[model samples]
Target chain A: MERKNFLRTFALVAATGPMIIDGCKKDSATKSTTSTTGTTTSTTTSASSGCVVTPTETEGPYPYVGGEATNPLNRVDVTDGQTGVPLSITFLVVNTNDNCNVVSDARVDIWHCNKDGYYSGYANQPGLLGSKSYVGETWLRGYELSDSNGAAKFTTIYPGWYGGRATHIHIEVYVNSVMKKTSQVTFLETISDVVHVSTLYAAHGVNPVRNASDSVFGDSATDLANEIMTLVGSVSAGYAGTYTIGLAL
Target chain B: MYKAKIKLVYKQVIDASSETSFEKAIIHASYQEFLLKSQAYNAEGKFKTFSRMKANDGRANSLHYKLSFSVLHFIEQLDNKIPVIKDNLGNKLSFDTAAFELIESHIEDSSLHKVAINYQTETLTLIDFMGDYLLLTSADAKSNEPSETFVVKMQPGLSIMNYQEINQFAINNLQLETP
Candidate 1:
């Protein structure tokens, strides 16, 4: 009887060992983004405590890197003298696998579209809004460094939605000038649907996409709720929101 | 995003059976969600920061990759294998170095991946990126003969492509480093 019991135990271990090993291999792919700092490459890394690196995303074509108004790393205000409702964004950078510790001194870059769904510096580009171009135009893109406590802030307008995608802002995190992660952050659709859409955003048309429907958001559905910014102000005076983004370095 | 699957044929040894378990290995690739390529990204910039976005159903190469990974990720294809490269300059580097120069430097969307790899040499002879997830096995690794060929099977969303169009489209966009 003892020998039979031992054989049964052995069978269970043998049956489950390979699966356990296989599960270890995929842990990184599901937990972290570990690719090089390419424009759209995603490798994998492991994270235990902090949030996994935001999934890497395409660096959309219009990352205008022209001049000062375009580079807003030092100051809190990033409006660049453009016309739109007032909005402010903040980012908190942290390291992963280390109890979500704040990663100080890292550089963060942010860029988004103006209220009309057009990006700056691309002239006469056709869009849902018609064929007007901001060629040589530079607004709504810049870089900033995380403070000693891992905080970076930008003053700008709420991003307007285009036809194909939900509202989003792109960001890149860097340590020692090495690109560590690239991802898009989004607002609650209710905020865009009722506030930004109803007020200054009305003429462009309603933001028809929702979180469940957007592909990018759907791809990372489990993390979407955590990545969204929490807001406080009204559309009349302009909305303000704060976000805590944990980056696994 | 559309739904699709890719297949990979491999050779696996069945120790308990004492024979080839199957003539070839079987694998499939599937995604939980896919994003259609965005139209807002087509405008030309003085300097390009990202690549073109093709709708999820339209990216042929990425589809091929999903199929490839469904197989390669499960098999023992690259362990301790060395691929041969004969360069005029006679340069030798570690696999990490070679992988960095060859795939890491050229492709964007750098994410540090967790993969099980064990190699004897520093040479990145085992793997290289063709397009997205489609990994190219070094032609020299399988003795003098090339390994089994990989093919991408089109699903419901893709229309058939002519020979010329296949040659015209890039497998993956390579970022040219500026001085």
Candidate 2:
């Protein structure tokens, strides 16, 4: 998808977060379908302008540590029995050096917290539900090598919010055993409002930290524009998100 | 918002099974777990380990006769130009040559088989083959231990690539045992 499309989608969601929350306070029961349909474009456009190198974001305290060496969980379904809003995340890795051509065989490592904001493979994760340590647990963590189309897809649930950071999924791309990119894919609060306030995710309430309040994504407009995932689908049926990442390698 | 700065603290590791050798059997089991779950081989391809022996060093039967050489040889082959361990602050631990050489030589000279990890001090553990040798205590102690046995039976006609089966077949059928 084009970068402009993602930016437009982000802007729409940026406005919808407050609207959805305010409506909920007044019991308006506004349908999210009206806003969701606005961002769904019919035409597919070239992403040549989106070819600029993806901004380097923090690897966050919970990286796999060994890149692809230690992580053996190569599966697409990283849910690992945890329940939440299903998210199908697709990362299109392109080369900034080579006219934005797709780069195949790049190793992509992904990890995020569950609906309760608990990350696996950590000893301590304190949050709203409770303080629990998931040391050695590999749920919501896996690695996938990019295919012929430079696409590495993962089947995971929509990650919940943590204390300081926004709702985001951590991503690291390695080409030829070298880390080409380390960044994150953030979700729009409009979508988070629908998913977080649902029956499954209602306990956590609404994630107060939107993209603008996030430590990593809050840095700049271009940061969210470059890192925000373009999500399609809904709160009830689940969402499929596509993000284009440009690597200099 | 402030970044949640979490440093690495060493977790306890223990032997998971008595019957299974830590080297091949356990590694293969984990490799199979990856293959079965992912349905795709690693980008580096199938799990493999290589060992080399010098003529006078082994004398054919010694248990620990310079494993450091082979370990260092593998380390030198890594094409990674940068450190893999990256935290929020971007301070990293690179697996450069000099550090491994020092650690290997120190271990060999001191005649110590195991290294102690201080839980109090934050340390970023380097990605060594040793991580595969032991299961972590709390999280993996239950499932990863082979003695506690859970079966992952392959479904009939599942389109998994036959490379692993073919390799196993070669090992079992084509071997000439020396009496």
Candidate 3:
């Protein structure tokens, strides 16, 4: 009976050991953020090869704040029935502090302007769409948790360009409920050039500011390379874009 | 005037039922509370201090309190002056600033009342100013103890693109402008 009891105890420990370790890991990650200095860059000290800390950019005036309390939509397709060219945007999040390993279960949020360059959940978006209030509308804004592979994808339309900015998408990476990075990724000029002239986007015309002239992206080559996404598709069949974000979490 | 409010609370299970392992006595104490100040300044060019209040439910197991000023006042404190730089080659480079940070002690004695007994912290945040609001990862550390700081990001009622826009919008919202 003693042996049986010992075996039962051993089984319980084996079953809960991993879960306890995970809880500790999450707790440590949380502690690091509170003690972190002002920089929004990665707080960890490890330098993994090929992992560049994604440049921190402004979430602008239109990121969906308030998390679950706001929209409460955990979806993969942020199109929200808006008509435009279909695009599959993929992000691979790796931890520079963890040997560039994929960060599974990280929350990734993607938001951008519709084809006419109007963002949802705002009343002051000025563009071809005029001054429209999408105040209650949550189109083109949603979040998905990364899978075991540290990747999240969104089925979004080709984003439209707004004044004072190039065609780009805003992304936020949250690991263990802490926002590690808030950045924007721009499409290659070659890709934006084609999508802007397509049927739905034609009304807005091509974006005047290219990647090299963008306020956030044009600053340096490293910025552009870190934030630029690669697209492989056409306006007719839609495009698939991929970007890897490195965080010093 | 407080424009934005952010609160982070940490809970601890002080006592639990041994039979059921159910939490019986729990402490839901606030780790931090940040209130953004709106007044221009006082006689000493200082902002009003954050109001502190504590409350307890019928259980009497938790402590709730408010402390610290909002990090947004950093915008009003800005001189709004753009610095011009000239390189050795006699070329002028225009500088445009977009973001600002207010670094301060994340843990105060009042904030540690029930959450910690003896706390020693060296961590801080360069709180990022996002136009009309502020975004930061709230953190604190305790020597030789397991500590956790929840991520806290906030947006005021209005959000804008740049500092100019934030200034104009804040002024209008606060009615600081004179006719």
Candidate 4:
């Protein structure tokens, strides 16, 4: 398939938030805790070998482009399972480069599943009501432009999983008014287990498995698997994760 | 439209061979020719020009062009140049040295946005073209390295847009001569 077509298909899957959320919720429940710090050298067999730094040639300033302004796919009502207070996850976009040069005007598109293993905008799924599941609610998932040092912050609910993928959030980066790249960040399955412990397991008595058995969690080199930490029991309901990504322009 | 005054500086450094003198003379002559063309464009309502000047530094093997004008006018001039002088065609226009190094080609239309040419330690930098500025640094120097930082600060009247837009315009319109 052509690269553009491939991207279009992947984008469709990405826009379909409920399917992804369901996959994640199912996998997170049965997964075992894995190491968060070690590199995926053993698993990533097809990693790109050449590491030359080549400057990218500029294209047209592609203006007035339009797609879906926001996703209405999956909505997870976040509540502190223990205290019953609503939980809001604060996401901070951090630049991976050492310079910390904030990428101003860079757009960040983020989406994930809700707590009950249902997505917001999926139509075919009988589980989702199809009408307007959190469609107008921009609070859970939305887009934000990075500030001077390439930082963006959002308050959202902790995402849940569905069938066979780990608990992860998908992010798309647009630099200089063009969509440049996409990457998914995963919490350490152990950390995901902790989240499961706080919500599903703690409330309904369920335990999720490791990423190795998940259908979507394959040996793909492109997957940026890593561990991130949030305050377990803070005044802010302690549901948050920080993800750092480097964009090559 | 609000009137804005801005300055643009173009710089280039050449090699140090016996032919260097000949190269320098040709560069000076070409610089003059380029300036005359720019002035003609300005007169034709391509840009509103306050002044355009050139300077040469033999010690650095460098030549510089400084232009001051209104932002909107300069952009208008650039809009014309963008389609005419592509990278390939621009290369054919002739550099004094056959080995003339093109450090950077940042032209938007006929209005030269920023062009830097370097020969050895001698560096050429262009700044404050209409609303934006370009900076060139030695590849060897660290970010915190204590080197003479060439600074050309612009006045507050100019507006800065996204660099990507300018770069894109340059790439699409860039033409080089097919040898």
Candidate 5:
């Protein structure tokens, strides 16, 4: 499925509160999604042009895009039933048109492949996910609604690689149900290398493709990096980082 | 007009014999529920109905989609006339729904409406029947082929993919809800 074809107009019905993006405390999470009725309307304010909201990439194939349910730990931790080193991901939702200040009430849904390069809730997947699909499994996926400072914190393992894309997490930030932006975040090549070579992701044949080799990242290296997270931890004791998403809306 | 969201409801016909595929029925019903909830259609393929079934005004209600259905034989007998859950493409997975159970079921007696089923072990939510699209297809003789065949109705002409991930997500967390 082309990234451009993944629709972004579904409702974001995750947890939301108010918090600072940079000062996201441990265990803080803000989940987001849109309402079903809102899907018919284009909530994304971006055109393929120079819209300041984060680049609108394809929604990928395995997003729980339309789900309104929240896991008990979806807010702060998504590694409930999976195995891997720990990772704490934090995101800050901001209105780019409004001087890039924090925007509260913004929802963010993040999903990535399990340590084995597989995604939950999918079947007959390509690469290592195998021919047998594992639909409805919500491991390594969660929701976070930014607090007053526009911050959402999630706890899970670092992402594994797939056939085409590098190690990355699919992030969608929405203002209520209207998706203000859809983009992705990745670790630095070296950092991801440590992740791919780890016991959790190595034996399963994680994608060997680097960021530069990834078709999407290669075409939009600078754009994708604009939203790359700033990390401050090791791949062993678990890593923690924060990302600020700029949306025109 | 806001299209009514297809609400999926599954009443636990806890059979002591557990002879048939009651558990599988929930999972199967869930797959069909996801299809109806995720993909909707009209003859023109351009129109939509947003007015989905409303369960209650609870924190749980707005967080997840609807899930409702009966045992497999009963559903199959409906002949797809009603919007029951199914794989759509006939891609029955090799995984078993009996491996799962509604470990945590929050029973809200305020009304026989709000229903939340969760896997007792994990943080995943199975089926949240907070009353959306309760009566999707009436038991009428309306002879419009089941919505599953309405592939052309997909706006982008995209096919509703398999339910492996969504189904597995719930199944992995499923447990046999003991009576």
Candidate 6:
């Protein structure tokens, strides 16, 4: 009985040994081939190779400024070819972390319409009331750096109502010379009615009704109506308004 | 006495909007990734076995190294899918994309060892593994004859660069008129 039990144990051990050896052999064989063929390439540290190094230089045929360059409205006239009483717009630029103070070098470029309901530099069509200057022209639309407070201001005339859409202005912001965002500001229609009745729109011969129907104006308009505010009791002279924008860099 | 011929094929397209600098960076990155991932196997002194093992088995550290390199090559190729833009002056710019592909190894030898790899936007095909023509006896019988032949194919995807990034880079770097 002792000899029989010993033989049984020996047989079982032999069977398991071959199975384990075979498994190890199979693994080794695979490793051999892989090592032979795999000596082809590497992956780690590859991502860093994608980095690009750029040279620094300054080059420009920058736009010209007219009127009071100190005010945002005047700067818009120089850039967008708009004239008359300038619109005062202000905005804050922030970064990915929602930090409003992005940096001093952030550039802000703004452009919009004129009092007579037309862009200055654009050639006026025969039937159009005002000259064409802003159409396709980017001269007046240029960039300006932010102050230490991450604040930027632009001076431009209140855009006349056009194309049945509300009056508005377009703005683009750049951080450290990189374009980061684009937006627009709208004016209240109720304010337009007030301007028309007060002769502010008439002083510039800009019919708010006509501007409300402009095709481009209609499509490009944003909701700046609530933000529009006229300088109280200044009905005799050109209209004045200010807009403040808060940006997420 | 066994002899075999191996062929390597690669294919890729530069995004139409990609700047020359960005393309250069991507190519360099790909090469680095490939080198880091490929492995070298030494079979000079080891005992020969009947069945083959998977390349990634931990017990086969040498083989694992090779597999890792192949995977790295694939990752590098796929990395091209990330769009890059650069100013003409060589400043790096950021962009986004949808997909990419990479193929590291597609090798075929007369020893009946065939490997085909396909990943991302690339495909590799290899054929003709250990066969009678790869045997020492067969080579001895045909001492002066040509060795076995095999084929490999690779189809790399297009690398796309963002138009807006390029436009911005050019405008900022080249003094080009803003449109």
Better of 1 and 3 by lDDT: 3
Question: DockQ of every model listed?
Answer: 0.02, 0.01, 0.02, 0.01, 0.03, 0.01
Q: Give residue A58's lDDT in candidate 1 (0 to 100).
A: 51
Clashes of 1: 29
Candidate 3's TM-score on the B chain: 0.16
Among these predicted structures, which one has the highest TM-score? 2
Which has the higher lDDT value, candidate number 4 or candidate number 6?
A: 6
Error of 4 at A230 (Å): 5.6
Candidate 6 residue-wise lDDT, A1-249, digit = tens:
554465468669867865654444422232111222345532221123342222212222111122122322223334344444444555556564564445565667665555545542243432235434332233334345667876666555556644444566666555543445556655555555555444445653435443335454454335333233434333345445544444554
Candidate 2 vs candidate 5: the DockQ winner is: 5
Per-residue alpha-carbon lDDT of candidate 3 for residues A1-249, written as tens digits (9 for 90 to 100)? 554465468669879866754444432232112243556643432123323222324433211222122223467898988989999988999999999999999988788989998886555667786787664456898788899999998999999888999899988777775567778999888889888998999988889998888888999988898788899999999999999989997
Cα lDDT tens digits, model 5, A125-189, are 77664565654455676667899988888988887766777778888665754555657788787
Off by over 4 Å in 5: A1-74, A204-206, B1-95, B98-179
lDDT of 3: 0.53
Lowest summed lDDT window (length 10), candidate 2 chain A: A26-35
lDDT of 2 by residue, A1-249 (tens): 353465467669878766654443433222232223445533322233332222223333222223233333667888989899899988898999999999999988888889988886454568986788664356788788999999999999999878888889988777875656668888778888889998888999788888886889988988788888899998889999999889997
lDDT of each: 0.48, 0.52, 0.53, 0.37, 0.48, 0.38
Kindly list the per-residue Cα lDDT of model 4 for residues B16-128, writing each as its tens digit: 22143333333333333233323322323333322221112122222122111101121221212221112222321111111122221211222322322321112222322
**Model 4, A226: alpha-carbon shift in Å?**
3.9
Badly placed stretches (over 4 Å) of model 3 are: A1-71, B1-179
lDDT of 3 by residue, B150-177 (tens): 2223322122222211233554544543
Q: What is the TM-score of chain B in candidate 1?
A: 0.19
Computed on C-alpha atoms, the DockQ of candidate 4 is 0.01
Pairwise lDDT winner, candidates 1 and 2: 2
What is the descending TM-score order? Answer: 2, 5, 3, 1, 4, 6
| lDDT at residue B21 of model 1 (Cα atoms) | 18
The reply for model 1, stretches above 4 Å from the true place, is A1-75, B1-179
Per-residue lDDT value at A239 in model 3 = 93
1 or 2, which is superior by DockQ?
1
The residue-by-residue lDDT of candidate 1 on A127-187, one tens digit each, is 6679875532347866678999888888898888666778888876777655666678888
